[model samples]
Target: MIARQYLERAGLHFYAANVTLRGGELDLIMRDGETWVFVEVRYRRTSLYGDAAASVSYTKQRRLLHSAAIWLTERGGSFDTTDCRFDVLAITGSQLQWLPNAFAAAE
Candidate 1:
């Protein structure tokens, strides 16, 4: 919720949330100008396992990519032509970090 609020404050238009298709779930989806953003939200109380951002491994990225593809395909309309990117919002304790274009679609 905090991440969604933060993103809204940053001027992105809300689209969808918890979009689960075939592969995985997208925490949040929003629009930034002409770009579509697929977001991953992560939280960690401590950095014992390299913090929340580091938790998004390559395998996770692949899943996210697959899910995004399915989401777009299912909801064609403008989404088919819109530019899209993956983003990560990580919360470690009280700190919040937003990483734009966190990863690309897996090959």
Candidate 2:
């Protein structure tokens, strides 16, 4: 995918893609040095309602959090120790925007 290539070119190491969990899916999983990044890719042909990133509602963020937790658990990782972040790749028409550390897991 173009998003994956873009991230890789920016120096993030690819770990996984299209990771499916019980509640949601992670479009890309990458590593920036020691940080684990969970990326959500959103695409829109036109911004009739809102941009692609804006489509990720609160409920969707919660689902992504749940899925990320499960993914980490399955890999013997812990949220307490593992440094992780959520990112969003928004694609609208021919424009692409990458938002890193876009959201955080609720405390």
Candidate 3:
């Protein structure tokens, strides 16, 4: 919710949220101009192990990619034509870091 509000204030148009699929859940979906953005929100009360962004592992990235693909397909969109990106909203305590183009689908 904080991430969504932050992004909205930053001028990203809100599209969807908490999109659950068989692969995984997409925390947020937004549009920056013409580009579709798939966002993952990670919150950590403390960084004892690692930062919130570091918590998104390779497996999680794969799952996000799969889920995004399915979502686009269901909405009659294709990666070949739709400009899309993956983003991460990492929250540590009261700090929020927005990382755009955080990952990409494997070629």
Clashing pairs in 2: none
- Single out the weakest 10-residue window by summed lDDT for candidate 2: 98-107
lDDT of 3 by residue, 3-104 (tens): 999999999999999989986899999999999999999999889888899999998998999999999899898787689999999998888999999998
Model 3 CA deviation exceeding 4 Å by range: none
46-93: candidate 1 lDDT, tens digit per residue: 897788999999898988888888888877733347699999999998
The C-alpha TM-scores of every prediction are 0.91, 0.95, 0.95
Model 2 regions more than 4 Å off: none
Comparison by lDDT, 1 against 3, better one: 3
Quote model 3's TM-score. Answer: 0.95
Q: List the residue pairs that clash in candidate 3.
A: none
Local lDDT at 35 for model 2? 95
RMSD, candidate 1, Å: 1.9
